[model samples]
Target: MLQVQGVFKSYATPQGPLAVLQGVDLHLEHGSSLALMGESGSGKSTLLHLMAGLDQVDRGTISIAGQRLDQMNEARLANWRRTDIGLVFQQFNLISSLKIDDNLAFQARLAGRFDPLWQAQLIERLGLGDLLKRYPEQLSGGQQQRVAVGRALASKPGLLLADEPTGNLDEATSDEVLQLLLDLLRDSATSLLMVTHSTRVAERLAHKVVLQNGRVADAGER
Candidate 1:
């Protein structure tokens, strides 16, 4: 569903142009799960941003579901992101003012695909039934993360982009949340590209890729 070729990205810093990715190539089949493993400066998040079309690439080609991302202008890409991709951040970027239910349904509604039945199912599956009326600040870390996961899946996005989705939770909660996310993605036949620090989590996915020194270090049969 996604293809990338000869991707390169660099940024100008105080020192000089800092290269994060160089001639990177990747291919992901539809409805599959993949993990991105990398050290701090390896550009894992930067690659994700490029893959999701959130950031522009200095050079290379990216295509999602047969649509060439490199060809889309800003306005076109913005709409594609809303309709085709679901993003989950490490910070659980929820609005403090919106209720839990509202936050979970916000993106889905924006995409014109908010289903009440599916929303109720997500609330139950994420174990946020009672916390629906509560605000993001009122919920525990795990609860808030669950809400974030729910929000990402509400629109039935074709692709899910998650960055350290379990970073803030305890080990037990992290495992629980990770399993929940995998299960939901599998059920929906949704493709997932996630950045994770844990090997155990990486092992559970269908594919694992390690980025190092601005190139792919490890990507073999799982």
Candidate 2:
């Protein structure tokens, strides 16, 4: 469902042109999950940003669900992100002013894909039914992340992108969140591309890709 070919990306730093990705080739099949592993500054997140159309690719092609992301204008990219992609960040980017219920339904409503039944189901499955009236600050780190996951899936997005999704949680909490995420994605048949440093977390996915020095060092399917 996602494809990248011969991708090269760089940033203009005061020192010089800092290249982060070089001739990177990656692919994810429909309804398949892939974990991206890399050390700091290895271009893993940069690749993700390119796929999300949040950053311009210096060279190469990125296609998602047969749509060419590199060619899309900003407006089209924004719409595609809202309609086709579900993103979960390490920071749990929730609206502080909105309550839990509003936060979970926010993106879905914006995408015009809101389904009350589906959202309610998500809330229950994520163990968030009782916290709907609470705000982000009122919940623990794990609870906030659960709400983030529910929010991401409420829209029934074709692809889900998670960046260090469990980074802020403890080991046990991280495992719990990861399992919950995988279970939901499997049932929903949404493709996943996650960036993580933990081998245990990466092993839970169907496929794995490791990046090094701005290139794909290794990739394999379990």
Candidate 3:
């Protein structure tokens, strides 16, 4: 469902251009999950951002479901992102002012794909039903992250892009959250591309790929 070919990304530095990703190539099939592993400066997040269309790649192509992200205009990209991609970040980016219910429903409503039955299932499956009345600030980190996952999946997007989704939790909580996420993804048949540093986390996915020197150096089924 996703493909990245010869993707190169760099940023302007005081010294010169700082290349983060060079000639990276990767792919994720439909209803499959792939974990992206790399060191701090190895460009894992950069490639994720390129796939999400949050930033344009300096060169090469990122295609999802046959549409080229690098070729789309900002307006089209924005629309595509809203409808096709679900993003979960390390920070658990939830709206503090909104209650859990509102936050969970926000993205689905925005994408015009809200389904009460599906959302009800998500709330139950994610263990979020009791937290609906609470605000983000009132929840623990794990709880908040669960809410974030619920929000991301509410629209039932084709792909889910997660960047260190369990980075803030303890080991037990992280495992709990990861298991919930995997179960939900399987239920929804959504393709997953997650960036993580933990081998344990990577091993849980269907496939794993390591980024070295800005390219996919190793990749295989777990």
lDDT of 1 by residue, 8-43 (tens): 999999999999999788888999989999899898
Worst 10 residues of 3 by lDDT: 213-222
Q: Rate residue 159 of model 1 by lDDT.
A: 91
Candidate 3 residue 210 Cα shift, in angstroms, is 0.5
lDDT of 2 by residue, 1-222 (tens): 999999999999999999999999999998999999999999989998988899988899999999999778899999999999999999999999999999999999999999999998898889998899999999999999999999999999999999999999999999999999998998888999999999999999999999999999999889
Q: Which whole-number lDDT from 0 to 100 does residue 39 have in model 2? A: 97
Model 2 scores worst on lDDT over the 10 consecutive residues at 116-125
lDDT measured at residue 86 in model 3 versus the true structure, 0 to 100: 98
Candidate 2: list runs displaced more than 4 Å: none
TM-score of each: 0.97, 0.99, 0.99
The CA lDDT at 81 in model 3 is 85
Better of 1 and 3 by TM-score: 3
**Which lDDT tens digits does candidate 3 get at residues 1-222?**
999998999999999999999999889999999999999899999889889998998889989999998778999998998899999999999999999999999999999999999999999998988899999999999999999999999999999999999998999999999999999999999999999999999999999999997888899896
Give every collision pair in model 3: none
Candidate 2 C-alpha error for residue 18, in Å: 0.6
Which pairs of residues collide in model 1?
A: none
